[model samples]
Target chain A: MEWLLEANTAGHKFALMAIAILLFAVVMGGILFAVDRPKRVPTWVVVAGFLGPTLLLLVVGLVYPALSTIRGSFYDKTGDEFIGLDNYARIFTDDGFQRVLLNTALWVVLVPLVTTALGLVYAYLVDRTRFESLAKALVFLPMAISMVGAGVIWRFVYEFRPDQPGVNQIGLLNQLLVLVGIEPQQFLLTAPANTLYLIVVMIWIQAGFAMTVLSAAIKAIPDDVVEAARLDGVGGFQMFRYVTVPSIRPALVVVLTTIAIVTLKVFDVVRTMTGGNFGTSVVANEFYTQAFRQFNFGLGAALAVLLFVLVVPIIAYNVRQLRLSEEIR
Target chain B: MTTTTPVMAPVPGEADTRGRVHSRAERAQKRLTSRTASVAAIVIAVLWTVPTFGLLLTSFRPELDIRRSGWWSMFTDPQFTVDNYNQVLYGGGTDFATLFVNSLVITLPSVVIPITLALLAAYAFAWIPFKGRSVLFVAVFALQIVPLQVTLIPLLSLYVDSGLAGSFWTVWLSHSMFALPLAIFLLHNFMREIPPSLVEAARMDGAGHVKIFFQVLLPLLTPAIAAFGVFQFLWVWNDLLVSLTFASSPDTVPLTVRLADMVGSRGSDWYLLAAGAFVAMVVPLIVFVALQRFFVRGLLAGSVKG
Candidate 1:
């Protein structure tokens, strides 16, 4: 039993994993077995058997914790004193947190807008081109890898060394700079531009998602609509601007809002690339830093609540757009 | 690739009109922007591809050469070795091998547990006639908007109080809980697409709900299951935050956490970092490439569902 809880060794971990699975199977199986005898069990009994565990887990895991964190936000740093709204006041007043909020704004605004635009253009370019899948796959490959993996890849590309007679630049970006007679710069260490550099990594990873969705939306455009637009002398970019963009407006909103939500919660990139240093800390990363590293419980809970607050409007807009599109359909 | 609206093939006589319209538009596109479009596409592809290629090439280079010159030097210099991979995998004190195993242990159950639970819940939401079914379904769907950040601190405290803080169980349970809403929503959408008549026919034959779920629906839900499975697999495997919060210890750390740690401590060691990054990347990359169809389907279904 103790080893099941504390799986320190490789063998113990695997054994413990087996037990966990087995335990889950038995519990689920027991419920099903008891309820499968139809005509004996009530409908609520079967419903409970099917949905009870999930509802219980959700209430315990998501709802309870979220409400508790919101409550914790009004407390003092130690989480023992009930200091009302002080944590929220400090978050709004502090200079470091102001930069965190501003940086988050930049990320939420930039990554989605640029990534969606790039994806739209790319999807349009290769819509019916030769080697379409292969071309799309090249950009889409980054979406497959971890953000940490992406951070490492881009870190090497941005790697800098002193530009002296004996030193050769290893990072490709710096090497390019040196070839044009510019000195090497530490891309990650600089403050404002560093945030942009980190955002580029996100755009690189997410362009595939936007491209994929938008490409499908482009293809789903009724051929007659395109033909009608063409008959109206809407050739070249006009066809795209009028026919393509309007047709995929719902998809465009979905991609933008989805990417915005993802970017808002982007902890991995900032954590991996800069570890939220040099003015790169966003709300998610700062939440982790305050809670885990500094052990500032109430402040961390406030940052976490701040993140939840920011996500509400975006999700509301998304749902409204979804409803509108569904109504039109 | 699955277009929701079917494309109607042009009738034989109308093909000429449609074809001419397309060709004229295409020719206009060609004459106006062929060169620029080609250049832009090529530039985007090159920019997207070269960084990963450079890192992959660097991973195969010797340590001294990697430190001395750019990976582009390989075209002129042409030196390569697997020693970096060797050192990263089996290197004393790095122990990426154990981290890799931890990733597998963490990911497999995280994928399986949530999926099974979501399948059952989705079935009930889609098929079972119950009081408050629509309200319950809508509640689960709405829960998808609860960002995992809000839940982490208290969830951590809850796990610590339960004495499961640093264990695999904590990671598994947290991931399972976090994944349920989206999983239930997606799987429910898929399940509802199945004709209710199938379940009705089974019910007419005196089959129970359990029998109908197992015999009629589970087979049909394979693609949906696979779709969410691939999504969850890549998610759990590539995850850093959840594992970093729950299982940061060496005994339970996955590849991403360990790799992120290496970047912080060994930021300058390109050889080890490059190879270690690939070690973290290889599984999800393979899964993505192989299951890309399901992944694309899942992504499209998850987002654009009008």
Candidate 2:
């Protein structure tokens, strides 16, 4: 039991893991065995065997903690004293916090629009072309990489070295700048633009997701509708505008809203690339920093709640759109 | 195939040939549109690929070579070694080998437990005549929208109070709890699509709910299970926030948390960072590339249903 709580070595850790899995298996197996007697067992007993763990976990894990966090947001830093709305006030009034909000605003606005636009255009281009799957896979590969990996990858690309004799540029972007006879700049150190730079990593990772969904949506457009548009002389960009865009409007909305929600919660890239320095922090990263790093529990909880508040409308609108689309179906 | 076709011979009652000619014309138009689109697509592909390619190539380059030159310089002066990988994996200070194992240990249970729990719950929601089934199901589904951030503070406190703050148990339990809503919703959707007759038929044969679940449903649910399994596998493997918050001790911290810490502490040590990034990424990339079909299905289902 003590070793289960504290595994100090590799052997101990693996042993603990095995024990945990076996325990889960035994519990679940016992439940099934107890309930496998058909009419001998009551329906409520059967239901409890299946649903009890999940329901109990949800109530204890998600529901209670979420309520506690919301409550914690109103208290003082140590979370013992009730300091009504001070954390929220500081979040709204503090200049640094405002930058976080502004950066979050930028992320919520730009990442989705740019990523969706890139994805939609890319999906449209390779919709039926030769080498389409391979090309799309190339764009979609980034989605598979963790954001921390992406952050490291981009950090390498943005690595800075001062310009001097015999000290060549190490970062590709800087080298490109040097090749074109321009001084290399600190891409991650500069304000405002640095946030955009961090946002690029996100867009890079998410474009694949956007493209996959939108490409499927484009394929789902009825061939008859396309043929009708072609018969009506809609060609080239006009076909894209009037026929393609309108046809996949539902998917486009879904892609945009999904990416926006994901972007709102993005933490790793900023945390990895800059550690939320240079005014690059969004609400998610700020929440982590406040809670864990600075031990400002109340402010962190407030930021977390702020994130929850921000996500609701987007999700609500997404559900509404999905419902509308389903109703149409 | 196109070269063998006659271009302008519209013979009588040869609708097939006419269709071929029409398609050829469409292909011609498509070729025209594809020209510009191809260029844009190529540019995007290059932009998306080069950063990752640069880091991967650098991971093979010697540490000094990496520090001194861009990876693109490899074309003119190709210097490579496996030392960076060696150092990152087994080097005394930056050993990723332990973290890699930690990632595997944390991820497998995290993925398996939630899917199993969600599977049973989804089965109940789909088949069992339980009171408040719809209400409870919707409540679980709605829990998906409650950001994991909201649960972090008090959950951490809960773990601290439970004497499990810095163990693998904390990470695994947190991940499984967070994954349930979406897993149950996704699995329930999958279960509902299993014709009700299948379960009813099993019941008529004197099979219990558990028997129907195992003998009838589990086989059909494999693909759904695989979809969510791959998804959760990749997610838990790549996660940083949960592992960082719960697994405060070195013994329990997974690769993402360690990798993120490396990026913070050794920001300039591209030698270590490059190899470490790959160490963290390789498992998910393999899972993703191998089970891409299931992964895409899961993604589409999540996006559409949500």
Candidate with best TM-score? 1
**Candidate 1 lDDT, tens digit per residue, A1-329?**
57777776778878888888888999999988889988999999999999999999999999999999999998877789999988888888999999999999999999999999999999888777665777788999999999999999999999999878999999999999999988899999999899999999999999999999999999888888987876676767878888899999999999999999999999999999999999999999999999989999999999999999999999999989989988998
Candidate 1, superposed: residue stretches over 4 Å from native: B1-29
Which pairs of residues have clashing backbones in candidate 2? none
lDDT over C-alpha atoms for residue A303 of model 2 = 96
Structural RMSD, model 1? 2.5
Ten contiguous residues minimizing lDDT sum, candidate 1 chain A: A229-238
TM-score of each: 0.96, 0.95
Give the whole-model CA lDDT for all candidates, comma-separated.
0.91, 0.88
**lDDT of candidate 2 at residue B266, scale 0 to 100:** 90
